[model samples]
Target: MVRSRLYKVTRGTLRLLSRPVRRAQGRGGIVLEPYRGYGSCDEIFLIGRVFRQSRPAPDADRDSLRDLWRDVGRRIARRAVRGAAVTARFGGTEQRVATDRDGYFRIHLKPRAMPDCADPWRAVGLTLDAEPPVEARAEVYVPPAHARFAVVSDIDDTVMHTGVANKLVMLWRLFVEDAESRTAFPGVATLYRALHDGADGEQNPMLYVSRAPWGLYDVLSEFFARHAIPAGPVLFLREWGLSWTHPLPRRAEDHKRILIGNMLALYRDLPFVLIGDSGQHDPEVYAEVVAAHPGRVRAVYIRNVSADAARIAEIERIAAGVTAAGASFVLAPDSVAMAEHAAGLGLIAHDAVATVRAEREAAPPEPATGPLPGVLRPTEVPPTVVIEPEGGRRL
Candidate 1:
């Protein structure tokens, strides 16, 4: 009993004295890293990071923010940062974890053993100790028992057309556009929202999983909010194979498979609807997911970014595989078709089909330039230097 009391006292003292989130009065800039998290009715998993803060040097006054080298210089200057105070609060329970040396942190919290939430989505508050106070929040998606399915989607070339198959074009568009300037594919917003708000208006959980790196978190998050897509966790991956000598980045198919597998593990009872574009290996990757998880996936929606016949045939075969595993799959060129299929499955409302068509007609069309010739699409070959819509220039 005496030792327990001492331990409690020490913990309280450390919590009071440490100011991990505070920086030296504008000298160090703080960034609260945000990522998507999943949870059941009993517990939630939250992962985020707290940067040590990157500030310009005294000599950086001469450099312009728009300078070509500015982003590189900033990256060289920043550090992963350790010991930062990060917090996640929800359901009357607040959990805290400190940033590791790599500036990453994870929170596994049970807000309550049995507390009930009215909506499937919950915003957990995160804060950094600043003079004016710096705060960020992450949304934790919890599907209700009656909810039919969850949605997992990819961003580039699927919902938002970036011409990702072509490196030069993808980079030019990514660097030039801000979140508002970046475009979403027509009708995607309506379809996604319908999936989020199901047939009876029960907000089913959704997650956006991308082969894009974690760096694009800020821009991608903004795009989702601006587009009015069903808000959930934005899941991303980091590229491997960057050494002192080998400078080129490498993306692996297994990274996607692993993340999706983890999601399946978390919600064993919940079925998912996988959505991605054919411009990349989404069909193959998601097919592997269906094979691995069996019936955990309720549906697979492959957006026909590449109209090539062979690619179409491959997707159809994958769809067949998914159906064999007891889930429906769709290879749709437009959002309305996918919406129609979703409605047929009782995943969304029947009227959502018209809403998707209207949204598509109302939205501006993408630039005339399609993917450049000779560069491989996601189905034929993996990209050597693919980047997301935001947060990165080179892969």
Candidate 2:
């Protein structure tokens, strides 16, 4: 409690001290910022911010680790979120919503009809009505009406090499490394592309859920682009709230479970292929999703980050239960293996397996390194926290 409180106070102090510099950069000016959002046939969820622009835009060419850091350095300031009139227009329907005090706004839509059958991606135009108006565009991916299944993947370790259990190393890789220099698990991109484009070549949505802080949103998005992985909504856990006086949510597991559950609920009819690593509580979190929403999860794929026999057994136990509950639970050693498993389950095309295998074979070898800390157990962590500098916190 004391640590969290002091953390907030410190961040608040820094923000106050940096206000002048940020204002000079037009952060004090009105702006509208939106991230990629997701939706189903009838419904859409759009999230974005309306605030004074705190940091100047970074170079769009920042696709490498070093170049990405250049942009990160440029965006060193922060701004307070303040409300504004935000609007979303699609399928001839326009709806409006107001940003929260934090300058975050979310809009929900029920389209009268979707786009033509040939194109599955929907473009949503978002604009903030304020002085010197700000405008941005976002996409809403609606998989084909008869799409067999969709994929929900974990970012760190599962797809990318983020040492989530080791906070210090995770922070370094998360912020300091650029996408080009940063390592994504070999063959993972090819496997994901196969899933996104499916065996039948139907465009299936790939939504990435991560425990990563939203501060690195740009870098992560760039990583996805470089990998040629089809992008959908990038949802992250609440920012870390280090508050001392009041209670805060603490379990990363709970936050993950809730988010995954919400996604399942939103796309009620679309079965999912859940992928995560053995590096964290994904096995437990995803297992719960499988048990709770039986049949909705077609398969649970766990990347083996730990070579530990006990951990494998634990995940296997969950796998067994998931199987009993009518889903396939795979203890995957590689992305290509998971691709093969998906194929065996008839979730993906048999030929896609060869594509993923070839990528694994052709990709450069992963630099030899020590294993990351063991995947966190559900019982081993505190509550999940959403980062909000309550009562003034400094960076």
Candidate 3:
């Protein structure tokens, strides 16, 4: 209770201090910034923001310290336009929306009949109601009916080498590093691509969920493109609160659980391959998901990043419940093991295993970041023993 009061006071003070500076700045015409949206055939969900001025693009060659700092400043110096009127047009339907105080608008459109197209992404035309009306195009991904199974993966530790357990290190990676400097886990790009391009030559749906705030959306998008990881339809990210005491997300478990549940409901017929790491509460949250929606999950792949004996033991217990609920729970030390298991299940091509292994072996070593205790590198740990619900088995 005391901490809550302190947080409120601190946030209010910061808002008061910034208001005059924000007002002093000159405002420009309305600009619509739309994020990638996704949904099934029956319904579509999309979200975007309205800003007074267009977003500033960073330098193409963002290598120097000056360029890096300038890029960060441009990305973070946002001026949102409140109560802006906008219209969304798609499927011969038009809907009007008003931006909230934060300049964010959400559209839920249930088209009478979706336009027939082979492409997974359908464009939604957006128009801002202003003196000189501004127009932009946004896209929503509707998985084709032929898509076999969908993949839902976490972004932080599962896909990349983010020191999420250490707040200072995580902040450094998130704010200071540019997209080109950020690194993905070895073989992650190949593994995700294989998952996207399934065994039977089908294009499966890939969705990413992260606890990172929406402020880092552009950086994350660039990172995925640079790494050649199959792009997800939507990036489920949380809003960063202004309180200094609670800079990071407070309830990571509930945030992830709700988003995963929403995805399950969106793709009613499609089963999912859930992927995350053991560094945080992923195992516990995924256990609840498996228990809540049995038979909907095909497999759960947890990258083993924690070296604590107690943490591994707890994860093993969670894996037991997950397997009992009828999904394969794989605690893998490296991406190669995950690829091999996926190939055996026919989730991906058997030949993709060799590709992943080769990439893992050829990838450059991680940059030195001094001594980080309690965090185990993949090369430092032996293969994790897979514990079956009824009986344990070695991977």
Winning model by lDDT: 3
The candidate with the higher lDDT, 1 or 2, is 2
TM-score order of candidates, top first: 3, 2, 1
Estimate, for each residue in 145-197, the C-alpha lDDT of model 1 and write its tens digit.
87776778888788786766667657534444446656788899999999988
Which candidate number has the best TM-score?
A: 3
Could you tell me the lDDT of residue 101 within candidate 2? 63
Q: What's the best-to-worst order under lDDT? A: 3, 2, 1
Against the hidden reference, what TM-scores do the models get? 0.75, 0.78, 0.84
As for candidate 3, its clashing pairs are none
Residue 139 in candidate 3 has what lDDT?
88
Overall local distance difference test of candidate 2: 0.68
Which digits, one per residue and each the tens of the lDDT, describe model 3 over residues 1-395?
97985554444333322221221112353557788888788888889887763333334333333443343343345566788888998888788999997789998888878999989889999888877777889988888888889999999888987778777667656655556667798999999999988897677889898767665676688789999998775565566633334444544334778888988999989999999998888899999999999999988999988666788888988998999988888898779988988898889999999999999999887775423533426345744756544666965
